[model samples]
Target: MAAARRRNSHVQRQRACADSLAEFVERSPSSFHAAAAVADHLASAGFARVEERDEWPAEPGDYVLLRDGAVVAWRIPEEIDDTAPFAIVGAHTDSPGFRLKPSPDRVAHGWRQLAVEVYGGPLLNSWLDRELRLAGRVSLTDGSTRLVQTGAIARIPQLAVHLDRQVNSEGLKLDPQLHTAPVTGPENGPDARSIIAAAAGVEAEDLVAWDLALADTQAPAFLGSDETMLAAGRLDNLVSVHAAMRAIVDTVPSGVIPVIAAFDHEEVGSGTRSGAAGPLLEQVIDRIQDARAVSPSHRARALGASWCVSSDVGHSIHPNYPERHDDGARPIAGGGPILKVNANQRYASDARGAALWAGVCSNAGVTTQPFVSRNSIPCGSTIGPITATRLGVSTVDVGIPILSMHSAREVCAIADAHALERALAVFLAGGWPEHA
Candidate 1:
């Protein structure tokens, strides 16, 4: 009876995690919005905001720091000596999409459309004929900014089947410069600034500039015969961000300090002020050390003992394209979280980091899979190697297996998201044995 009760409890927790992910994706339509939502969550969980310009307090409590589209939150253990290491969970908040150009509002040949630049490597074909909405941060003339989302305000219509009869034999070819523009209306359509102003509850004249992107209008939903799958946009990294946030917020800290670092601009190259390539994470670590008045030697020792789990989505074996994956290391949709390894250092996982993550998963009663890209195919990267190289901390790359990555929409098993959260919570709670 006790074992049965424990099983039921686990099921309940999994259900909660899955439901939370759906809500999080729905609320975060863009990278700026995602960061804001994470900050709100941390604040509600009793994490105080710490401005970078101010000195950090040395008290043991929860705290968070924010850059434009990035966020980092941590909890100080009640007892603070100079020996504790940092346990960090890192994830990106940005995804591939079309960003509006400087002169976005254009009318040509009686059709009013918005010009856009492809922000990252998106599946351009997947965006054709999809209803889209605008969402992002709008900078006002008064030097203030507000988040806005005009739901289902535009669309990219495909050419008729009769007009493109050879489309079946020859797949559709899209030109990012020409065919990807989204239509809003006829020649005399409503102005884009007016629409943004109305949504933001500000005057149209006050809208000086904006950082806007077109997002899918379809709400995320459960798929599969038994409703065990998730279909949504931005799942490539948002899934990781959500899991990390929950783990950091819920886990009780041990001797090690737990941190959540959700960065932006990762899809492009992570080169912005709010990206992993910037100095935000390092500055925060330095501030923490200064607040505690730790000596330089002790600080170096603490950093050497620190570990980071870089959370991002991994590719799942496609039933139709099985040859694309390594036969021995392919991951499945519902197989639980995956540990990504690459000899070329595309990923930062080494044998020691892999063993540490495996132990965390084992302690959480979760199974894990390994992923290595096939020899012929080139592999993509995450923040793992960048963070490790920049901070000199040991790092591992891990995430839930996903399909249709970088598409306007993607797929993953709902159960796998829950499993990843459970394991991440264990890691953040410092369940791993301390290094001698």
Candidate 2:
């Protein structure tokens, strides 16, 4: 009876966590929307919003900062000072997709299309014939920007099989410029910008500039016979974002400062002002130290004691392509969170960091798996190395396991997602013995 009760409780938690995650993904269609959603959620959780133009609060409490498409939130304990070490959880807000080009009006043949360019590497074929929405922010002539998203108004139609006899066996080929323009309406229908302006409650002519992306219109849903799995778009990094945000919101006061940094433009090498490659994290940390009035030597001491956990999604072994993964170490869905390892420094998980993560998970009563790339397969990078190198702090890369990563839609085990949040909560709340 006890075992049965425990199992039932775990199932309920998994479903509840997955439902909340789906709701979050539904609200965030673009990087800007993701950042704004984080800010709003933090506000509701009693975090005071601070702007870059104003002076930061010195008193110990919860605070958040929003910079364009990125968000950084921190919790300061009442017993803390400028010399307190930081317990940082890092994640990214952006995902791979197509961005609408300026002056996207196009009429090719009898079809009216919205011109778009590939923003990042995506599974091109996965986008074909899927209902897609246009979402992002548009700058008005009056210097104000509004977040907007059009209902299912466009689609990238795949060529008919009858017209392309070899599409299945030979595989479909696409030209980013020639084949990827999404058909919005009939050739004589309203212009793309006009449709977009209506969504933002402004005239087309009032739109001075805009940044938009094509996003899948499907809502996340449960999969499998037991309904223990979730399927949704933007699961690559949003899973990490949602997990870290929840952890930070529920964090209690501790000896170290708990921080969560979710940045944009990570899909395109993270070189922008709001990305990990830039100085956003560093600048925010410096301002925080200044407001607390810590001396230089103590600041250095705090820096040495700080630790970061870079969270993102990693690939799960595909049943059909099992050989493609490292035979020795392939994480699977529902196997709890993964500790990513790469001797090449691709992932910043050294022996020390791995030990720290293991202890955190163990203390949280969470199981974990290991992930490594096949020698022939070059591994993808995350914000872990960037944060470690730039900040010169101990860092580890960790994430939940999911399949069909980078697809228009992806799938992950609900249990794994739930386990990740539980583990993150422990890390943020200072379960590790050395965090102070």
The best candidate by TM-score is: 2
Clashes of 1: 0
Error of 1 at 194 (Å): 1.7
lDDT of 1 by residue, 1-436 (tens): 9999998887677768878998999989899999989999999989999998888999889999878889999999889669688999999999998998877787879988988899989999888888999999999988998899997878888888899999989989888888899998897988787777888889988988889999998999988676788899999899999999888887987778899999999999998889998888998998998998989999998899899999999999999999999989989999999999999999999999989989999988899999999999979999999999899999999999999999999999988999898898999988885451
> How large an RMSD does model 1 have?
1.4
Model 2: per-residue lDDT, tens digit, 1-436? Answer: 9999998998898888889899999999998899999999999999999999998998988999999889999988888866678889999998998999987889999889998989778888889899999999999999999999999999999999999999899989999889999998789998898999999999888998888999999999999899988999999889999998888887784778899999998888888889999999999999988989989899899989888999999989999999899999889899889999998988999888888889888977888889999999989899999999899989999999998888899999988888888888888887785633
TM-score to true structure, per model: 0.97, 0.98
lDDT of each: 0.90, 0.90
Question: Using alpha carbons, what is the TM-score of model 2?
Answer: 0.98
